[model samples]
Target: MNFKKCLRCGCFFASEDSVCPSCQTKDEIDKNSIRNYLANNDTPQNAESLAFQSGVSIKNINRFMETKEFSPLKNSFK
Candidate 1:
């Protein structure tokens, strides 16, 4: 397996995924949090607002928005 730098923790690991194994769990949890927030509330204007209201960091919000599952959400933002 090719080594890649973990996007969340900056650690080098052998994986095709963006984050390391440990961080993958955290990513799942954060994604759940975001989904819960969006399910109950109106979509925020942008990542910053979503991050603030969802208690997730803007960095993570931005990162999540890059994925195919969340890419449409990025288009919703200004």
Candidate 2:
């Protein structure tokens, strides 16, 4: 795997790790948040619009929806 420098701390490491160990902030999208956005509404819809409505980032929504790795937690939104 290729290495990348952390945006927050300037630590160099493998790109496979989502965030730098030095920085708690995530470089990759959060799937749980994305799933919460997608597995909503009575009607099927676009991910971007869903993200807007759900107040999650569009990039995160797109990543989860496209990857199809969204695991919804039941009754979480309620």
lDDT digits (tens) for residues 1-78 of candidate 2? 789876445788887654476553442435444445456754235555556776666655444443434424222222
TM-score of 1: 0.95
Clashing pairs in 2: none
Clashing pairs in 1: none
Clashes of each: 0, 0
The 10 consecutive residues of candidate 2 with the worst lDDT sum are 69-78
RMSD of candidate 2 to the true fold?
7.2
lDDT tens per residue, model 1, 1-78: 799999999999998999999999999999999999999999999888999988888898889989988888988888
